[model samples]
Target: MRRVIGLVLLLLSVSLSAQALSWAYAFVVLDGRVYEVMDVAVLDDDLGEVVGEVKTMADDMDGSYYGDASNMYPIGTTYRKVNGEAIEDVLAVEDESGWKRAEYRHDAPFSMRDHLDKVAYGFVGLGLVVFVMYRFRRTR
Candidate 1:
């Protein structure tokens, strides 16, 4: 019984930790301003030239949950991207340099951030199943 409880607690702790990490927002400093990349997407093909690199990183884990983008876009790394056209609070940009009428499609690859909630729920569910199985076995 005690072992089962301990196992459940451990699983719960791990789930909570994953939840915390899921809430972390990746931020990037561009043009002297800090902008949180709402959706970190990877370009399918190399299109643009190296415009800028991540100069600094600040991870504020206090409560706001803002973190650095070193994991996805590491510091000193450069990628190809066309000029950015700000759309409200989001920066919509193309990945290659081409004529305005050129056809282009930017499809983002699979990202774990998109399914973090499901993963967290899976952890909790596994913990619950373990606890229930332990109780069932003791009763039997």
Candidate 2:
């Protein structure tokens, strides 16, 4: 029983110690309101790197009805970590009163930068595999 409890504690600690993914923030001034974006990227910090992304509209009312027919609406921006490897996607949808709603997917690895790099390498490997297959097919 004691060993089980110790194992459980160790698992919990490992999960808790996982670093948070860092996100890049992009800001724009639109109609006197500041709109900020969150996307995957490397964040400079003492702990090395962090990754994740977010977009925020400040001091704005939260409602969908206010968006109006005009397309001056706030749309989510796309973010790619480690050049153009993994993409962190976000979308903005109109809510009850012209308010923009943020919907995000939180399934990517905690280290956006590192994971993105891995993605890059994976793509390279995939490309090589495709090339080899193509060459073999052509030879046959």
Candidate 3:
């Protein structure tokens, strides 16, 4: 019973840790408000290393709408982390160099980051399987 409880706790801790590391954040000024982006990336040279982000917008008077940026933002624009507010509520965007600020906006989600994480997990899982199998065969 004790061993089982300990194992469960260990697994829970690992899952929580993995969840914490899985998401990445960036900030941009879209329109006028500041927004914390769930995912962002530097565009390739072919795209000019500049990205035009399309974000969702809403106001009290106007209904929710989607807005696309007219200007392109550099991929590596620098941003500083902000504190005081809850992590989820705080948007990390640079006012000057990191990123150009516009109104608060929610950009289209980036999937490449998610794909990369899955790929990394795949390689790690493969490596562990090979190592375990080798050890088992050696013992036999």
Task: Estimate the TM-score of every prediction.
Answer: 0.31, 0.23, 0.32
* RMSD list, candidates in order: 19.4, 17.0, 18.8
Q: List the candidate numbers ranked by TM-score, top first.
A: 3, 1, 2
Residue 25's lDDT within candidate 1 is 43
Q: What local lDDT does model 2 show for residue 5? A: 100
Which digits, one per residue and each the tens of the lDDT, describe model 2 over residues 31-134? 22223333322322211112322242222332111111112334443222233322233223232243232223333223344356679999999999999999
Considering every candidate listed, which one attains the maximal lDDT?
Answer: 1
TM-score of predicted structure 3: 0.32
Off by over 4 Å in 3: 1-78, 94-104, 110-113
Per-residue CA lDDT of model 1 for 1-140, tens digit only, reads 99999999999998887432333444444443344444344444533444445543443342221222332344664423444423223332222332111112222234454367578889999999999999999999
The clash count for each model shown is 1, 24, 11
Give the candidate number with the greatest TM-score: 3
**Reference-based lDDT, each prediction:** 0.44, 0.38, 0.42
Candidate 3 residue 100 C-alpha distance from true site, Å: 7.2
Candidate 2's displacement at residue 115, Å, is: 0.3
lDDT of 3 by residue, 28-118 (tens): 4433334554433312221222223434222223222233312223334433333333323333433333333222444434435435667
Backbone clashes in candidate 3 total 11
Off by over 4 Å in 2: 1-110
Q: How many Å off is the CA of 135 in candidate 3?
A: 3.5
